[model samples]
Target: MKKAVFLDRDGVLNEVLTERVKFVNRPDDLYLLEGAAEAVAELTKAGFDVFIVTNQGGVGLGFMKERDLKKIHGRLEELILEKGGAIREAAYCPHKPKAGCECRKPNPGMLLDLARRHDIDLSASVMAGDHERDIEAGKKAGCKTVFIGEGETSADAKAPSLQAAVKDILQLLAD
Candidate 1:
C-alpha cells in the first residue's frame, strides 16, 4: 500500500477568507496562503503523494457553479506544479449540510473513496487541515490526522502553519 498526504483546501492551501468567498467560481478569487507553495514542495520532496479533499458546499447552495470550482482547482494545480509540487488528485463534497451527503468531511466518504482508488495505506498516511471536521474525517479514514489550527490537539497533532507541519512530518519520516 502507498502512503499519501491528504490536505484541506481552504486554510491549508489558500488563505481562509474572514468571510466565506461566495462565487469562488473564478480563478481570480483563488489565492494561495502564506508559505503554501514552499510547504507543498517540501512535502513532495519527502516523497508523499499529495491529495486534496475539500468541502465545497457553495456549489450546492448555488453560490458557485461546479465549473467554477473546477477552474479554481485548475489554478491551484497550476500554481503547485509551478512550485515543483504535484497534487495527485483532488476530491470535494459539493453537497450542502442539509443534503446529508456521505462524501462530506466528518463522514470520510471522500477519503475512503480515494484510498480505494489509490491503494492508500491509511495508517501510514497523514491528513492535514485547519478544521476539526478534517481531523474527524482523517480519524474515520484511519489516517494520522494533524490539525492545522491554533489549539494543541489531544486527538491529533496541531501546527499553526503548513510549513511547520511539513517540517514535523519530515522529521518523523526521516526517522
Candidate 2:
C-alpha cells in the first residue's frame, strides 16, 4: 500500500485573499496560497503521493461549468510543477451542498475512491483542509486529519496555514 496526503483545494492550497473571494468561479481566478506550493513540495519529497479532494458545488448550481473547474485545476498543476511539486490527481464533487452525493466533503467517498484506485493506505495518510468537513471526511476515511486556518473543529491537528501545518501533518505518520 502507498502513503498519500489528501488536500483540500480551495481554501487550503489555492485562493485569492479568501476574505475577498469566497470561491474560484472562473478558470483564471485560481492562485496558490502563500507557501502552499512549497508545503506541498515538502510532502511529496517526503515520499507521499499527493491528491486534491475538493467540493466544487458551483457547477451543480450553474455558477460554473465543469470545464471551468478543470481549467482551474490545470493551472494549479502548472503552478505547482513550476515550484517542483506535483499533484497525482484531483477529484471534486461537482454537486451542490446536501445534494446527497457521496463524494462531497464531510463524506469519505472521494477519499475512499482515490484510496481504492491508488492502492493507498488510509491509516498511513493525512488529510488537511480549512474546514471541519475536511477533517470529518478524513476521519470517515480512516486517515489522520489536519485542520487549516481558524474556527473550530475536532481535527487531529490544527495550524494557521498549510505551510505551517507541515510538521503537524508529518507527525501523524509517526503516531
Q: Give the alpha carbon lDDT tens digit for every residue of 1-175 in model 2.
A: 9889999998889885566576798756887889999998988888888999999988999999999988889889888888888899999999998799899989999999999999999998999989899999999999999999888889989999999999998888667
Cα lDDT computed for each candidate against the true fold: 0.84, 0.90
Q: Give the backbone clash total of model 1.
A: 0
TM-score for candidate 1, please give it: 0.92
How many clashes does each candidate structure show, in the order listed? 0, 0
Off by over 4 Å in 1: 19-23, 171-175
The 10 consecutive residues of candidate 1 with the worst lDDT sum are: 16-25
Q: Over the stretch 36-150, how does candidate 1's per-residue lDDT look in tens digits?
A: 8788888998788899999999899888898989889989999998989889998999999778888999889999999999999887888888888898998899888778879
